[model samples]
Target: MLLKKNEIVEIEITGMTAEGSGVGRVEGIAVFVPGAAAGDRLKVRILKTAKTYAFGKIEEILEPSPERIESDCPCSEQCGGCAFRHITYAEELRAKENRVRDAIERIGGLQNPDIHPIVGAEHADGYRNKAQIPIGQDKQGNLIAGFYANHSHRIVQCDCCALQPKPFEQALDAFLEWARKSGESAYDETTHKGKLRHLYLRMAEGTGEVMVCMVVNGNGLKGEDSLAALLRERVDGLKSVLINSNREDTNVVLGRRFRTVWGQDFLTDRMCGLQFRISPLSFYQVNHAQAQRLYALAGEYAGLTGKETVLDLYCGTGTIGLSMAGRAGRVIGVEAVAQAVENARENAALNNIENAEFLCMDAAEAAQLLVQRGEHPDVVVLDPPRKGCAPELIRTVADMAPSRIVYVSCDPATLARDLKLFRELGYAAGLITPVDLFPRTKHVETVVCLSRKNPDDRIEIDLDLDELDITSAESKATYEEIKDYILKNYNLKVSSLYISQVKRKLGLEVGTNYNLPKSENTQVPQCPPEKETAITEALKHFSMVPFK
Candidate 1:
């Protein structure tokens, strides 16, 4: 049962990988087939083989899976944009949820991750609010616009993708018409001699405002006016047309320089009951409606109270931080992008959120800066990029001693890795929620709630006592009870700090400010011999410890 190249074999797909590849076993050897649906029995041609696994291509469908569907997009196989287009949405969600579960349990080493069922979007069609289609030309020099092939820079021409809104299709069509007449050559990556490189698009799902930005190699488009006029005529609610100049040869889609050729330079979108201005490079979620649900869940897991200071790292346009500003006493947002930080500050002002402030700095630097400024955040919200937060940043934030950490991640593997690190640093994560913000694609969003472990290794849950039926009372003897027991039984008084220091000496977790001095000038008195003897006797009297 060794899998060889071009060898055809029949197998039944039983599961899917996180990358949306169907997995089937042949004599105990796993074959990974892309564009395959689970429960499908198919004849697969082995393309590549390894020691324990192999790569395959679907040769013939012996029996189609019950979850299979006819793909609406013609280029769904070639384009890497959507992986689940050929499968039913329900089945797709199952795969994504399983992916999260596997990552948290298998990779994260958590026995009970407490994973909730994934929250699927209401509808999958045309949910993307933004798109960046690379610009290319056919052999006949006809301009083409579509996504790049999977794992390659070669363009796969798709006039209308199902994931994008109608405005994108209209704008793309208009660009092709104008560029065909104006003779603007597509950027050749090899020679780097052309002007047009990528067609960037953003739409305000709430306001229905559309923005079209042409990413180019040189200064600007030669016939930008005609292009703008054509876009305005074809695309409804055309709000802006601009150019991003990236003269250097790089893989980055948007450039540093931007110039508006028509209309305004930005588009505004509404999310979580707040207005946000979206620039070309703003880190806004692509799915607008689903984003509201995602943010609401993140906020709920954060468990913010009015007396707590909240820190939001990688606060893209301050969306999550601004949403929780009302519930939190003070909100501080930190981001690396200057433009996004500007938008975040403006968003706060636009929403009249006086309690929130935004800073433009890297997350690790901002965390250290906040620590230096004596800002103690009770809750910290982290929404990092796909690569997840750096280990140093996680340690710095944990050092801030936030009571709760809400981690929203796009990559499950990295999220699991970070959660393991947090556990080692005394934060235990529970109740991870997977969200399908990007339907019909392999991408899934997950939010995990981690709480600092107490002395008994129990999580400190911030909630109403009646709601949770739980209190912050220690399991063992209360500090006041211990003090009274010593004073009454042995006729000696003891301070709570001294008792806490004893607990620390016995390897118990001493909470914040228990036995530590307030400042450098503050002196703490040590427990006298008589007080220590009385405390040890009280410990036995109260059945707290067995002492001779």
Candidate 2:
């Protein structure tokens, strides 16, 4: 049927697009409806009709899919923060995994590739580590702190959000009161005026320390001391307070104007048992618990030995590199962000970790320096940003020829491309694990492990072993049985099992943090019902490989 603009058409959603659009097809033409997802039969009014595609707004969900959930946020459809809030948690994970796989298959030109299931978040809600709220006043003249609307720069007041902790909302309220008492005016986007512009809040996971930055338009603070004191008293977890004055007309970020007025300039947090100090603009994982798991997977893929030295390229605040420092002899983290480097140093000092170091430099430059210094790292872990690593850095890593290369990426297409390049340079792609650090969003984090290629290492053997009575077993049996047990239970090949068993025996526990109890007999905790099936599906697809 030929659909016209403003025509009401009911279509079954088949998939989700990267820009958070729900996709359907009608009469062999692609129809995209906003706020629609797979399995949903929605009644949408066509907004625009193009030659090959049509855009529509969902009038009603004629028949909601089983995978749909009642969104907890009041402004779910309007707020741009959560793109998948209407979809069930399981469906969200599936969509994200599919997005990565599809991107890899389509963009990277990889077919029939073994892709691991995505490791999901244990606590989906209140998992965000940072929250940025724009200071705006509604038409009725009430100050609001939340996010912008879907397609507009105008801020929408979000009272209850599933992503942020309860304290954040309270802190927002407290900040508003403080602003009123201080006579601070909210920034007006239309007129380009006002004193207060934005409130950036970041909380440390393990320490619960908070850093709040107030972006202002002018230098003179009318009630700086009083407002700071009030925030410290009212906000229970606040550790750092900063005022960043942006006097320029352009919308550039506040980088240098930050002045610390309270406890510390940065806050500390732990991921994969490694400590890090996060400054105002430092890049840390928004979801803390999931990050621990994500980092652990990266370390495991790196296959680090106690004697191995690691180069953590694009290591923002040294989160991944610092976490793996206990296992690696020395960790050199290089990031382009200077503030992040300072935070990384503070984090190392706070944790009393001496073997880790951080430097502020471009990743490609750092890699080149390593080459110039005649230093080759045994393991090279690259956790580049969404833009991915530069071609030069990739080439440098290939030339250096590390024993193991761990590539942690937020984008899968880039990761697959890098892995393909590494494969061309005599490195075999080992294990690729997808992690869902952000629930109810299209974003997915991936960890890819690559090992140096050796033509002579071709013997393949299974290491599965049944549970044995360690008390009665001899020394040889204990070792052999334990190795086989890990292989059998974990379903890995001999070499992989051997390395994992050795790490465990040597008390080097690496990988994502599972909140296992301190008690020896405690069982692994269970995920929420909505997320369990997705995790099980992911685990089924998870496997190790040996490339010849």
Cα displacement (angstroms), candidate 1, residue 490, comes to: 41
Measured with C-alpha atoms, the lDDT of residue 212 in candidate 2 is 76
Ten-residue region with minimum lDDT total, candidate 1: 462-471
Which has the greatest lDDT? 1
TM for every model, in the order presented, reads 0.85, 0.79
Off by over 4 Å in 1: 458-548
- Model 2 pairs whose backbones collide: 117-538, 293-512, 296-511, 296-512, 465-484
Task: Evaluate candidate 1 by giving its C-alpha RMSD to the native, one decimal.
Answer: 9.8
What TM-score number comes out for model 1? 0.85
**Model 2: how far residue 521 lies from native, Å:** 53
Note the Cα lDDT for every prediction shown: 0.86, 0.74
